[model samples]
Target: MSVYSMKTGLSSILKAYSPTEREKAKNIAINKVRFEMPKLKGILDAVEAVNEHNNFQPLNEFVAYLREAELSDNDFLRLMSDAHKLINDLSPKFTNLVEALISLPWTKRQPPALQAYAEFYIDIMVAHNKYVQFGIPKLISLWIPADGDAALWPNGSPIEALKTELEAVHRLLDRILTAIPMSFEIVLEAIESKFPYFKKATHVIAGYIHSVLWLIEYKPIFTEFVVQLVLQKLVLLDVNAPRSEIEETDYDDEELEENENAEIFEMDDCPKVGNIFAFLISLTTTDDDVQPMKHPIAHTIDICMEKMFNFLNTKNPNLLNASAEQKLQLNKFWKILLSAFDNVILPSHNTHHVQFLLFYYCSFKNTIAEAFLTSLWDKIKNPNISAVIRQAAVGYIASFLARAKFVHLPVLKYYLKELCNWAHQYIQSCDQYRQNGSLKANIVFFSLCQAVFYVIAFRSRDLTVDRKSLLFLQSLQLSAIVTCNFNPLRVCLPPVATAFAGVTRAYQLAYCHAILERNARRKLATVYANDVATPEETLDTFFPFDPYLLKLSEKRITLHYLQYQASEAEEASVVAGHRSPRRQRKRGDSEMLDDVDDFIVADKRQRNIELARSQEREAQFTYGLSPGFHM
Candidate 1:
């Protein structure tokens, strides 16, 4: 008979006999056989027979019967209960039965059937401990909705039905954990192995991430592991998704407004007309001179980042009014986040957006901010840490202090003093080694000095607000640090050095014009001397916590972010004379005027050069060179 005829005939046969009648007939046939056999032995023989024949008729029939039977059917419940008892006898060799059980649709079943299936699943794993390895993976596979179902919910909101199904999955997992406490490692392994690839559909990845976060609530022991895993994935996406790609994509305001409320799960529903990946790919084909492009993952990064930020914000909605218990919980959460930062985010290079999660979290309280600053300072001061990490740490500290609107003046001054004191001590200690040291050897000191200057340039208005603050700034001996023999002005990026010089000169805190003039002349002379100028050192700008540019998360960051603006002094000078005095030549002191003019011209020229170089390195650090650094 054809396959259709066979299926029709089987369906008719199943319909002809109720489960009760079938069980009674089975009993009668066994009695007539006149053979004494244990029930477990009979089950084993049936399984062996199925395997020998390479047929799954019995398994298929059982699944079909369960599907067709009513939830309250006693025969269905008893059959499942008996199968639960025979779980111990089920072996890997019983492939058909194992496959059938694994393939059962628990998600759509009624509560009683769902419970029965869950119990049988747990019993099988509990009976055969090794099955946990396979079973946990199967459960994890249900974490993401099927693609067709995801398409149905195009807005990315979790479907209520699917949510209920996932809740059942988690509860089943909870019971499995209770029965097999030692299977935690197996579950973790399964989760990691099944983690959605970063390039997968945003909803799929977000769904898995949401499930992982949900798992943390019930299994608190997995907090650190889960946090770190999520962060690692976020970092992977952040690093690959260059901010420039997003900026360069051709999108209109209406589309951006539409996408503003879009969740990670809703990325598929996002319009493809202005997609960064599509724009980039189009460029590749249309322009013969264009370089090959890496497909942009910015949308994916934005979704993941928004999810994480939401997760954290929900955990500590009102830190101020939180009770002691809530405070303790927040504290524990902070520790886990900090630890994850150190292990995953800290060491990472070229990550544009993931680090802002720490920034947003620290904004909750002054104590958290202070603690974060202290952590970076400790790392910056540690001589044993790698220079690269120390450099990145100092960059983070500077950016955090400059951009964080919540950091009060005293706190800023306190850290500024700390940084200046450290720079002073470092300059003094490195003075003896300065003669023999290469720029690479003392890069950390140069980085620290750059950080101090960058922060001072950013907060120049606050620093020189009054006599007391000016005196405090003067007392930090920034002049001495800048004028040190090490010559950090020349070693740091030109734009930062120029801004620091301009701010100090305007405030009368330091006289760096001469040093900058000298450095600029030397750079020019080196270029003239070589037929092909080879730079002695190439320093990529390191600003870890720059403007958070991910479109979806920008609102959260912008509220707390202190944007760069001209100081009152500079603004007034511009209003009065159309240019600052430092930019114009002085009346008396022709030599000094000449020096200032040369410094101005050279600063402008050096900026042009640096801009070109920055463009070259744009692929490596998209946000590294911010326009805010320019005076």
Candidate 2:
């Protein structure tokens, strides 16, 4: 056979089999009619029945049939599509149908069916605005997976079902928000009411966290509200999990290892025998055989923090690739985070880890770090603020300066100088007024002094890098602040006071050993004289940005943390040509003996003279401020 003949034969065969354009159109129209006829009939029947009887029983029956039927994914999708077409006929009066539709396990359906259900929900919400109050909460409830259902797969991956459901739910939310923007108020309220409690299973709380982050991604308008809400919840958890308890309890290595390996979602039914959650579960069981676990609240806190840290990192903008608008948005978010920190986390005491959210945030830029320091400083200096809040603000500032590696020396010195100056002015004011009140009366002054000492103890090496820096440090007059009548060294935490003394003595910046020895002698005398009824005054060792202890979230913290270097203090002492002679001296050495003798003599002379002056001025001087005088 010739090639041309074969080709001609094939072409003729193809031409005979192919349909005409008109026939193709006719077939499409015929299929459309066949598909829509039943759907139209169902929609008309539902609408007509509801309009005729002025009740939703027919629509309710239709929803119940859809729920009871084990239809294939495509059939279910077609029926939901038909339901969507009746949205305009539906109203707030269709409560029974709405409730039945809401009760369906739509999240368990396949992707196409899930999407069809979401569309129907959105269409109903948009067509009847009053239905939004019901629809939004129903969708939000799907964000938290029910018990035994979090792991959809037999293999038990965490939050797998929740992730799938949230994807569809958030898409439905985005569509509804676009159609009726006013529905967001309902959305926010539902989210708040549906947020999982801190004591709920870790995966359940984590599922809600995932949904929140998803909302922020799809709906940028919720960014501020979501950030505040998450932080507030985190603060709640943080306060409950006290750092003191974490420190006091000794966790076994095996238990910690078990907690690390245990799956988050396995807590409800099959917790590992000795893991943290199992210990937590034991509390509810009637059996008294199980011993208490160490710091189970800490474990919950770690999981919550890990999720929150990941959310923040996701929302963190990349400075290298971000545009101006992105940067502006980031700045706005930073401000919101700062506001939440001030309102929620700052006033909270004994919180172990919540403030790290702000710590992680300030690392985004140097300007943010500076701004945060400035805010803390403003709080510290503002007299109108409560004493307790001002004290906490100072602690935050000091801890931030001490532990944040990203804070440059110039910034540290700037705040250090500001703190010292504030303390100096406080001392001067006390002196000018002869306000020699007790330690309790002058607590804010002592707190400021302690913060100064703490910052210097942590950053001594950074502060003493050069002659110019040394001069700057000397100009702060820290010696005057320490030697003031308020006597911070005597009232502050012993280790802090000792560390500050060692650092100062090594640098020749101040001599505190004599004063410390005198205070120690006075304390002993008071104990011996049965004068111990006076409660000892001391500042709490609250380093807010201390080492991040969460095993999962520590990675986010360590990259920006400035670890304490014991060698820095020793090296600074060596370089400054000052070494402790007490280490080498015998107890009876004459030089040490003479130094002690001189301290005792000076203390006695000052006390005698002050006692005489007090006797003379008793009638004229008052313990408190005089009339018409203001501090």
Q: Pick the candidate with the highest TM-score.
A: 1
TM-score of each: 0.75, 0.73
User: How many clashes show up per model?
Assistant: 0, 0
Model 2: per-residue Cα lDDT over 1-631, one tens digit each: 4567587764333333346876997667655543444334554586687799765555654654544545577767876786777778767666666666656777668978887887787777767777777878888887775666545422112445455656767777788888998988998999999998888765577667767877888788898898888878878877776654664563444654454355233433432443455445434553123232246666656766767777777657665788888888887888888888888888888666899888887887788889999999899888899989988898888888987878988898888888888887887887899986576677678878888877776676677677897788789887897787777877765445555665676567887766666666555565457645343455654667765556555666766777553324344233212222322221111221112111112223444344333323321221221110000
Instruction: Tell me the lDDT of candidate 1.
Output: 0.69
Q: What lDDT score is found at residue 28 in candidate 1?
A: 71
Best by lDDT: 1
Candidate 2 yields a Cα-based lDDT of 0.66
Q: How does residue 225 of candidate 2 score in lDDT? A: 91
Please provide, for model 1 over 511-630, each residue's C-alpha lDDT reduced to its tens digit, 9 standing for 90 to 100: 876776666566656656857664445456567776565655555676567755546664444332223343321111112221222222222444534443432332222222552332
